[model samples]
Target: MADTDLLKTPLHDLHAELGAKMVPFAGYEMPVQYPMGVKAEHLHTRAKAGLFDVSHMGQVELPDPNAARDLEQLVPGDLQSLEVGQMRYTMFTNENGGILDDLMVFRLERGLMVVVNAACKNLDIKHMSESLTGPVISHDDRALLALQGPSAEFALSALAPEVATLQFLTGKWIDVDGAKCLVTRSGYTGEDGYEISAPADQAEALARKLLAQDDVEAIGLGARDSLRLEAGLCLYGHDIDETTTPVEAALTWSIGKRRREEGGFPGADVIQKQIAEGTSRRRVGILPEGRAPAREGTEIQAPDGTTIGAITSGGFGPSLEAPVAMGYVASEHAAAGSAVNVVVRGKALPARTAKMPFVPNGYKR
Candidate 1:
């Protein structure tokens, strides 16, 4: 869709004023990059702090008193065990065990605050409304933003001093520049950061405050994708989707141990079976030998030229200064150091399965 017809976030005008190159993404007109270009923005994010406008994503409130228990039935997380002000990364599974969508569930004092992907927000809410007999309210009046990197706390604390004490994966309602905001010490860039859910009207002002810091710069989606890729974070609809199971996607770590044994959520039986036994294939990091960056849909083959899988996410790692990729391959070939071939064009390119997080993660755990 064209930018004219796409939805605009609260910072849309601000992005334009910053000379951002707008692009249509997930039904929203979002910034892809600024005049500084993608490479510089990406490197700056690793060294300092980068501010991102993530308002296009959905913020929903599950207001039912039994929100935790009710939510447990939909996702494979131990939501009932979550302490107030805690957040979890989990996914909604289908009856057949495929991922419906990956979401962040935050336990709040009044109810649960959930963030879903922009593209899947509507469907996720619909799924929840039909699955659980609770009130699902979408907070369209809110805007989301992220400040990430080693200096994230320094940048955010200048405005909200209390934010400096927040631990990873924790949240609280606090005053940010006189505006009530839901602030969480979490981010998608594998850095020590905070995600702020602020009132729509105050979002732009809050963003400008953060950017005013000497360590912070406005980042766009282009650098966002590269940073997350280097961190081995999955991009919904690409790395994971309705056809991919959590086990196959190597996301078993996010599945709570209690949920593993209880077997209550969707596709529990199949997932449990896969957990005990094993799946035929598994997701693994691919290190392409040459400078040529392999892209998504590139074919994977064994040493003997037998086809095994295809690349789901692939790109050059700016942090590593080399080409890195990830794909699902046969279980036997999924181990690190196992040799594989990535067919970029017609030729089979030499590559190997390697440990993920192409760069070291900087999450302040």
Candidate 2:
């Protein structure tokens, strides 16, 4: 889609003023890079702090008194165990154990707040409404921003000192410049960071204030993609989809022990079975030799050229300074250090199965 035809976030003007290269993503016009380029933007965030405008993501509230109990029927995560002000990364599954979408669930005082991919928001909302008795409400009047890096805590603490004391996967309501906001000690970059959600009208002002900090700089989608790749996080349509099972996607950890044993969520039968018997194929990390980068749709082949699986997501890792990717292969080929060949751009590039998180995550515990 063209930028002119896409939805614009509240920070659109700020991005343009910063000389960011705009691109169409998930029905929104977002910045792919600034004048500093993707590589520099990525490294700067790792060393200091990078602010990202992710307001295009969908925020929804489940207002049922039994919101947690109702949500447990959709996802396999143990929502009941989630303490107030804590967050959990989980996925929606279909009847056959396929992943519908991945999301973040925050346990708020009055209700449950969910952050889902923009493209999947409508379907997710519809599904939730039909599946549960809870009242589903989408917050279209909000904007989200992520401040990430080693110095992220310092930058946000200057405005909300309480944010600095938060541990990973926790959240709190705070006052940002006198505006009520939700600040979560969570991020996609695998770094110590905060995700702030504020009223749409106040977004630009809050962004400008954060950017004014010495350690903070505006970042774009290009660097954001690379950072998540290095963190071993899955991008919805890429690494996982309706055809991928949580067990097959190496996301069995997201299934809490209670859900695993009780089997109440959608696809609980198949998912629980896979947990016990193991899956036929599994998502694994692939490290291609040399400088060649494997891309999506690349075929994974055995030594004899037998096709096993396909690449879902792949890109250059700025933190590792090498090319890395994730793909699903047969169980036999999913072991770490196993040799495989990825057919990238018509040539079979030598690749080895490696452990995930190409770079170590520095999230504060």
Candidate 3:
């Protein structure tokens, strides 16, 4: 709420020293952009590498051997199938089958390492504690740093040579800048990268080391938004929320075949029904005809003036050099190339539904 009450990430001073313009986000004072500007920072990541301070996100540990089985009660992912060191993306759902929060679950040797959104982490923890068995541990002393782009491997390998062995959606314990850290060869920026969870005390030092490497720029929230938007990734509380089902979000793929058939998770019945019968609306990408970006909440309409949907996330894609967006529209209009119009400032802008990841994903399989 108040600026004085905002939480500071471990890299706060580093961000300030790098000339970042700070703002309040999810109860934290974070860098919105640095001196290089959002556009330059964005292109830098696409061309080289960008370092992001995502410590605001929550990290939780489920230490029980039955964590996977316990997890199936909350989300639809096939967690029991995950091998050691592998990671999967899924979401927490409400009883109505609407998405509560999206998260990444890493099956480590001892337990499960889960990373959730900053805005929803608290509720996710409470929900998990109430539903799962004992001992849900929160990592308040950890900081997460995302090194993303083509050079991510090259830069990160200098510190943790073993990191190069990790494929996409995999993680392992490693020493980064001499700090015992959990390094994952995974990212959501549609680029090759790693997410490092390091001790808070050692975070700044590790971040500085990564920054010292060639081709790594300190990125802030401004570019982060554009990068994820271009990548067609959903932002919680915007593109998805308590009212949107996984099927409606086009995220049915995250549901494992067994889970889909068994129908054991919260709202699984509703999700199964949606899987058999199509949902009323589905998420899809939209490309505006011109440079004027269709921002979130902009109403989407059919060519004949019938309202079809609204833009949940929209912005100028530095990599695509065009305005890219994703939103939900009636299932009939969700098909790529379907004609649509985005109402921005009471004027209709010609647009069309397009495929996601407006920028091609570069993840290493």
lDDT of 2 by residue, 100-197 (tens): 99999999987799999988988999999898897999998999999999999999888888888899999999998777999999999888899999
- What TM-score does each of the candidates earn? 0.99, 0.98, 0.99
Candidate 1's TM-score reads 0.99
Give residue 280's lDDT in candidate 2 (0 to 100).
88
Winner on lDDT between 1 and 3 is 3
Compared with the true structure, what per-residue lDDT tens digits does model 1 show for residues 81-146? 889999999999998889999999999987799999999999999999998888999999999999
Which candidate's lDDT is highest? 3
Candidate 3: clashing pairs of residues? none
- The runs of at least 3 residues in candidate 3 whose Cα sits more than 4 Å from the true structure, single-residue gaps closed, are none
What does the lDDT read for residue 254 in candidate 3? 96
lDDT of each: 0.92, 0.92, 0.94
